[model samples]
Target: MNSDHYTYRVTWSAEDAEHVGLCAEFPSLSWLAATPAEALAGIRSVVADCVRDMSAHGEPVPVPLADRRYSGEFKVRIPPEQHRRLAIEASEQGVSLNRLVSAKLASGA
Candidate 1:
Protein backbone atom coordinates (compact mmCIF):
# COMPACT_ATOMS: atom_id res chain seq x y z
CA MET A 1 0.00 0.00 0.00
CA ASN A 2 1.24 3.46 -0.85
CA SER A 3 1.00 5.67 2.21
CA ASP A 4 1.24 8.70 -0.04
CA HIS A 5 -2.10 7.77 -1.58
CA TYR A 6 -3.87 7.75 1.77
CA THR A 7 -6.33 10.52 2.64
CA TYR A 8 -4.69 12.97 5.08
CA ARG A 9 -6.02 15.94 6.98
CA VAL A 10 -4.47 18.56 9.28
CA THR A 11 -6.47 20.55 11.76
CA TRP A 12 -5.98 22.56 14.91
CA SER A 13 -6.49 20.95 18.29
CA ALA A 14 -7.65 23.48 20.84
CA GLU A 15 -7.38 21.02 23.72
CA ASP A 16 -3.84 20.10 22.85
CA ALA A 17 -2.87 23.63 21.73
CA GLU A 18 -1.26 22.14 18.63
CA HIS A 19 -2.01 20.82 15.20
CA VAL A 20 -3.24 17.29 14.63
CA GLY A 21 -2.69 15.07 11.61
CA LEU A 22 -5.20 12.38 10.73
CA CYS A 23 -5.35 9.62 8.18
CA ALA A 24 -8.83 8.60 7.09
CA GLU A 25 -7.74 5.04 6.28
CA PHE A 26 -6.14 4.64 9.72
CA PRO A 27 -8.69 6.22 12.00
CA SER A 28 -6.88 5.01 15.14
CA LEU A 29 -3.60 6.74 14.22
CA SER A 30 -2.87 10.41 14.78
CA TRP A 31 0.10 12.76 15.28
CA LEU A 32 0.36 16.06 17.06
CA ALA A 33 2.88 18.84 16.56
CA ALA A 34 3.27 22.54 17.03
CA THR A 35 3.05 23.09 13.29
CA PRO A 36 0.80 21.64 10.62
CA ALA A 37 3.70 20.62 8.42
CA GLU A 38 5.39 18.72 11.23
CA ALA A 39 2.14 17.09 12.23
CA LEU A 40 1.58 15.90 8.65
CA ALA A 41 5.13 14.62 8.38
CA GLY A 42 4.85 12.82 11.66
CA ILE A 43 1.63 11.10 10.68
CA ARG A 44 3.01 10.06 7.32
CA SER A 45 6.09 8.58 8.95
CA VAL A 46 3.97 6.71 11.45
CA VAL A 47 1.76 5.33 8.71
CA ALA A 48 4.79 4.23 6.71
CA ASP A 49 6.22 2.41 9.73
CA CYS A 50 2.89 0.75 10.42
CA VAL A 51 2.60 -0.39 6.84
CA ARG A 52 6.10 -1.85 6.94
CA ASP A 53 5.40 -3.72 10.16
CA MET A 54 2.12 -5.10 8.91
CA SER A 55 3.76 -6.22 5.67
CA ALA A 56 6.61 -7.92 7.56
CA HIS A 57 4.07 -9.76 9.74
CA GLY A 58 2.07 -10.98 6.74
CA GLU A 59 -0.91 -8.85 7.78
CA PRO A 60 -3.24 -7.23 5.30
CA VAL A 61 -2.58 -3.54 4.92
CA PRO A 62 -5.48 -1.15 4.44
CA VAL A 63 -6.08 0.24 0.98
CA PRO A 64 -5.75 3.99 0.73
CA LEU A 65 -9.01 5.89 0.30
CA ALA A 66 -7.67 7.50 -2.87
CA ASP A 67 -7.07 4.10 -4.39
CA ARG A 68 -10.53 2.73 -3.60
CA ARG A 69 -13.32 2.72 -6.14
CA TYR A 70 -16.83 3.80 -5.18
CA SER A 71 -20.03 2.74 -6.86
CA GLY A 72 -22.43 5.55 -7.74
CA GLU A 73 -25.32 3.70 -6.16
CA PHE A 74 -25.93 3.31 -2.44
CA LYS A 75 -29.01 2.40 -0.41
CA VAL A 76 -30.50 4.67 2.25
CA ARG A 77 -33.41 4.03 4.57
CA ILE A 78 -35.99 6.61 5.54
CA PRO A 79 -39.40 6.67 7.24
CA PRO A 80 -42.25 5.52 5.00
CA GLU A 81 -44.04 8.86 5.47
CA GLN A 82 -40.94 10.80 4.46
CA HIS A 83 -40.47 8.52 1.48
CA ARG A 84 -44.05 9.17 0.41
CA ARG A 85 -43.51 12.93 0.75
CA LEU A 86 -40.36 12.78 -1.35
CA ALA A 87 -42.13 10.68 -3.97
CA ILE A 88 -44.94 13.21 -4.18
CA GLU A 89 -42.44 16.07 -4.49
CA ALA A 90 -40.58 14.23 -7.24
CA SER A 91 -43.86 13.61 -9.08
CA GLU A 92 -44.75 17.29 -8.78
CA GLN A 93 -41.38 18.24 -10.19
CA GLY A 94 -41.81 15.82 -13.11
CA VAL A 95 -38.65 13.90 -12.15
CA SER A 96 -37.78 10.50 -10.74
CA LEU A 97 -37.24 10.12 -7.02
CA ASN A 98 -33.65 9.13 -7.67
CA ARG A 99 -32.96 12.28 -9.68
CA LEU A 100 -34.56 14.51 -7.04
CA VAL A 101 -32.60 12.87 -4.28
CA SER A 102 -29.38 13.02 -6.28
CA ALA A 103 -29.86 16.71 -6.90
CA LYS A 104 -30.54 17.34 -3.20
CA LEU A 105 -27.40 15.43 -2.20
CA ALA A 106 -25.28 17.21 -4.81
CA SER A 107 -26.44 20.50 -3.38
CA GLY A 108 -25.32 19.33 0.10
CA ALA A 109 -28.83 19.48 1.55
Candidate 2:
Protein backbone atom coordinates (compact mmCIF):
# COMPACT_ATOMS: atom_id res chain seq x y z
CA MET A 1 0.00 0.00 0.00
CA ASN A 2 1.06 3.56 -0.65
CA SER A 3 0.98 4.89 2.87
CA ASP A 4 1.34 8.37 1.49
CA HIS A 5 -1.95 8.13 -0.39
CA TYR A 6 -5.28 7.28 1.19
CA THR A 7 -8.84 6.97 0.00
CA TYR A 8 -11.38 8.64 2.23
CA ARG A 9 -15.10 8.33 1.69
CA VAL A 10 -17.36 11.23 2.46
CA THR A 11 -21.09 10.77 2.74
CA TRP A 12 -23.86 13.33 2.93
CA SER A 13 -27.42 13.22 4.23
CA ALA A 14 -30.24 15.72 4.23
CA GLU A 15 -31.18 17.27 7.51
CA ASP A 16 -34.76 18.08 8.44
CA ALA A 17 -33.75 21.68 8.90
CA GLU A 18 -31.33 24.07 7.25
CA HIS A 19 -28.03 22.45 8.12
CA VAL A 20 -26.06 20.34 5.66
CA GLY A 21 -24.91 16.94 6.87
CA LEU A 22 -21.65 15.16 6.05
CA CYS A 23 -19.10 12.68 7.31
CA ALA A 24 -15.68 11.47 6.14
CA GLU A 25 -13.75 8.38 7.15
CA PHE A 26 -10.78 6.25 6.23
CA PRO A 27 -8.55 3.91 8.20
CA SER A 28 -6.26 6.89 8.68
CA LEU A 29 -8.78 9.64 9.37
CA SER A 30 -12.35 10.28 10.50
CA TRP A 31 -14.52 13.36 10.85
CA LEU A 32 -18.12 14.50 10.70
CA ALA A 33 -20.26 17.60 10.53
CA ALA A 34 -23.83 18.74 10.10
CA THR A 35 -23.38 19.79 6.46
CA PRO A 36 -21.49 18.53 3.45
CA ALA A 37 -19.48 21.71 3.17
CA GLU A 38 -18.68 21.64 6.84
CA ALA A 39 -17.71 18.02 6.64
CA LEU A 40 -15.29 18.73 3.84
CA ALA A 41 -13.74 21.54 5.81
CA GLY A 42 -13.43 19.36 8.88
CA ILE A 43 -11.90 16.49 6.93
CA ARG A 44 -9.37 18.83 5.38
CA SER A 45 -8.27 19.84 8.83
CA VAL A 46 -7.84 16.23 9.80
CA VAL A 47 -5.86 15.47 6.65
CA ALA A 48 -3.57 18.36 7.38
CA ASP A 49 -2.83 16.82 10.74
CA CYS A 50 -2.20 13.45 9.14
CA VAL A 51 0.14 15.01 6.64
CA ARG A 52 2.08 16.77 9.36
CA ASP A 53 2.48 13.57 11.31
CA MET A 54 3.59 11.68 8.25
CA SER A 55 6.10 14.39 7.42
CA ALA A 56 7.63 14.09 10.86
CA HIS A 57 8.31 10.42 10.21
CA GLY A 58 10.74 11.30 7.39
CA GLU A 59 8.12 10.66 4.76
CA PRO A 60 6.92 12.85 1.96
CA VAL A 61 3.57 14.54 2.24
CA PRO A 62 0.74 12.51 0.76
CA VAL A 63 0.83 12.24 -3.02
CA PRO A 64 -1.14 14.78 -4.97
CA LEU A 65 -4.89 14.06 -4.75
CA ALA A 66 -5.31 13.52 -8.47
CA ASP A 67 -7.47 10.44 -7.96
CA ARG A 68 -9.65 11.74 -5.17
CA ARG A 69 -13.27 11.59 -6.22
CA TYR A 70 -16.06 14.01 -5.53
CA SER A 71 -19.69 13.49 -6.55
CA GLY A 72 -22.48 15.88 -5.77
CA GLU A 73 -25.05 18.23 -7.17
CA PHE A 74 -24.08 21.87 -7.33
CA LYS A 75 -25.63 24.90 -8.90
CA VAL A 76 -23.64 27.39 -10.94
CA ARG A 77 -24.99 30.65 -12.26
CA ILE A 78 -23.63 31.78 -15.58
CA PRO A 79 -25.02 34.42 -17.85
CA PRO A 80 -26.91 33.18 -20.89
CA GLU A 81 -24.04 34.09 -23.14
CA GLN A 82 -21.53 32.09 -21.09
CA HIS A 83 -23.97 29.22 -20.83
CA ARG A 84 -24.37 29.09 -24.61
CA ARG A 85 -20.60 29.28 -25.04
CA LEU A 86 -20.05 26.34 -22.73
CA ALA A 87 -22.78 24.41 -24.48
CA ILE A 88 -21.13 25.00 -27.82
CA GLU A 89 -17.79 23.96 -26.43
CA ALA A 90 -19.31 20.83 -24.99
CA SER A 91 -20.85 19.97 -28.31
CA GLU A 92 -17.57 20.50 -30.12
CA GLN A 93 -15.82 18.28 -27.63
CA GLY A 94 -18.51 15.60 -27.99
CA VAL A 95 -19.17 15.59 -24.25
CA SER A 96 -21.88 16.70 -21.93
CA LEU A 97 -21.55 20.04 -20.19
CA ASN A 98 -20.90 18.27 -16.91
CA ARG A 99 -18.16 16.14 -18.46
CA LEU A 100 -16.64 19.16 -20.12
CA VAL A 101 -16.52 21.02 -16.86
CA SER A 102 -15.13 18.04 -15.02
CA ALA A 103 -12.45 17.52 -17.63
CA LYS A 104 -11.51 21.17 -17.53
CA LEU A 105 -11.21 21.06 -13.77
CA ALA A 106 -9.14 17.89 -13.85
CA SER A 107 -6.79 19.24 -16.47
CA GLY A 108 -6.29 22.41 -14.53
CA ALA A 109 -4.98 20.41 -11.60
Question: At residue 87, what lDDT does model 1 achieve?
Answer: 100
Q: On residues 8-90, what C-alpha lDDT tens digit does candidate 2 reach at each position?
A: 55575444333322223234465666666776667666776766787789876645454456576678888999889989999
* Tens-digit lDDT track of model 1 for 1-109: 7789998999999999999999998999999999999999999999999999999999999998778899989999999999999999999999999999999999998
> What TM-score would every model get versus the actual structure?
0.96, 0.37
Q: List where candidate 2 sits over 4 angstroms from the true fold.
A: 1-9, 13-27, 67-109
Q: How many residue pairs clash in each candidate?
A: 0, 4
> Which portions of model 1 show Cα errors greater than 4 Å?
none
Candidate 2, residue 1: the lDDT equals 23
> Which lDDT values do the candidates have, in the order given?
0.95, 0.63
Clashes of 2: 4
